[model samples]
Target: MEHEKRDHALLSASGANRWLACPPSAKLEEQFPDTTSDAAREGTLAHELAELKVRNYFYTTDFGKRKLNAAVKKLQKEDLWQDEMMGYTDQYLDYIRVVAMADRIQGTAEIEKRVDFGRWAPGGFGTADCLLLKGNQLHVIDFKYGKGVPVSAEENPQMMLYALGARDMYGILYHFDEFHLHIIQPRIDNVSEWTCTEEELLEFGSYVKERSALAIDGAGEFCPGESQCRFCRAKAVCRARAEENVRLAFSQDKGKLPPLISSEDAGRYLSLGEDVKKWLEDLKEWALGECLAGRPVLGWKAVEGRGSRDWIDMDAAFGKLAKSGLAEEAVLWEKKPLTLAQVEKLLGKKDFQDAVGEFVVKNPGKPALVKESDKSEAITNKVTAAEAFAEGGES
Candidate 1:
């Protein structure tokens, strides 16, 4: 599956959350060139593969099937391709089938449909991964291949913008009464959805119009917060964000603490700590980049950090070890069983479950403090302790 090239809007739907919060950031980010990371490239590959599968399944023809097979072969030859991608994509396909069945309407499914919402947002348009229209209902399904952060469909600016664009494009023909936004993150096993009435969707569209007007010209004040700043291009040197985190870090007089801090103060500091840490890391990365580019930071200089050596020819090295009477299993190599996930992918899901499902057991995850808005259910201390004890006894 070859990657498709798409033009990005200045106020891209994907970056709407950032620009909507801090309007000036849309302009501020323009000074920096857009860059793609390995993770991003891998995600692009995954999306391409997914689109191929969707087209093949929904609009199947002999030629389309042949094209799909050829594309899959090309994707497999890519450097980023992994064996697990097939299984993950199959899961996504299964979910799409379920959604189609639930819709109960033999509606049309468009792949990589381009939509425009320029009526509300100036020059706002994006490609939706999939759009299923079923009897006055519009379904926008987005595939998120990244595993680092779980994205939700509830009031998500990106998904909302996608939905808005979709509606503008299809509303006249379909007279949509409801909009369904879905995010499927197969890598992290997250599937989230949010449905909105036409009235609610229009109300949100008006809000987006107001914000887009401000964001297009970078007319609003800089609002520095965690979620918006996380992916901002200028975050490394953004004075507003720096001041925000710095003020939080030194809120107490002389940056000092009392002899004993109250629990409330401790909780506040802990929440602030994450932002401060991220800011510090960004600052260091910026300085390193400057130094590497031959621009001197006040007290920084680029230098070699560390290095390690590896065998030039593993087979030759191992043969030499054997000549010295070293047992292959003793030092050269050792056998280990595949991890649960690796085995699951190696054998299909049903086969793997039939083979070793009884031997497999899942332990309770460790408890961690998170924001109240997190979707995960809160665990009580009693349950945590009991689960810990149960695992200990089993061991």
Candidate 2:
């Protein structure tokens, strides 16, 4: 299905993770006008390209190949196509094909499959990137082209909703026993997979039914958190979220007291860190948006941003150089192949392992101050929990 045909509803399945947490966000977001960024458009194109490639592999190659090429050329014409985008899509295709190899004889695969959960969520519908079914198990593969943050599949509400929707769509047709959720974020080398039985999925459906009803009717409370408000449209103007952050961040640590943080307070601060970071970023963006639109905030005003220059017409410049009779090699130099990180991203983990793994040089990065809950060990070896307090430093 073409992404252009995909409609944006106030309670979309993609934003289920958000609205389910902060139920009022569904209604709050409606008040703000919907707008798509260039990144979103590029992601749409990547999804289109991925759909085309997967379809070609499974069904039509000669005819579908033509359509795929045409779609790519159109995107290239608009300067939306990039080498990196295709690499990401290719990684998605590679994963699908690899999984297909496991059940090559019995598995059924569908691309851009639509699922509707309007029974619980009013007008709830979304297209799954890919679904593979075999015997009683179904695999739901979602391709996230974004590189900003690594998304995990373990108990991920978004992927769970996709699984629920898939079950609703194909439950009767195929009596699947297990649903496997796969989130392949090629840019971040994040390939997380989680499996849940039909019982677990149905249990989640109960939660979905209760929360979705509230969100669809705009009746649930605005309980704020990092996961919910990170991409929320109303986060900047969310009174509940603002209040929650202020309340969480306002510490009662007196100067007379010991600098050591109690275990409970440390836990609380850790939970607040993500939300505070998101709130600060969202507030900055909101202020900037308001200022750019000629409605500057009373206290915070906008200044010219750090800007860079770009070539007006690179082709024109190259064309003139071509006619000047200078050696082509002298005018334009060949670039070396991308570095390890770049090549790994270009080829993906599996392909990179097959092609470039032998060339990788492993090294440990210098660790910094991370939460006590972090998996990695601390860089400073002297102290552990209250290292900051032991030293003459603020906790």
TM accuracy, model 1: 0.89
Scored by lDDT, the top model is 1
Model 2 lDDT-worst window of ten: 373-382
lDDT tens digits, residue span 274-359, model 2: 68877988888988989989996998888887999998997777778878875666657686877787877666667889986787
TM-score for each of the candidates: 0.89, 0.78
Query: What number of backbone clashes does candidate 2 have, counting pairs of residues 3 or more apart or in separate chains?
Result: 0
Name the regions of candidate 2 deviating beyond 4 angstroms: 61-67, 103-105, 253-256, 259-270, 304-363, 369-395
Residue 327 CA displacement from its true place in model 1, Å = 4.8
How many clashes would you count in candidate 1? 0
What tens-digit string does per-residue lDDT give for candidate 1 at 1-395? 24547888887888888988898899899999888888999999888889989989998874387899998998899898887787778888888888888946888898888778787789888778889989888889999899988898998888778888888777678888888999999988999999998888888889888888988888989999888999999999999999999998887756656789898877878888778889989999999999999999997788998989999999999999999999977887988998998998888777899999999999999988887777789887666778788888955
lDDT at position 98, candidate 2: 87
lDDT scores of the candidates, listed in order: 0.86, 0.80
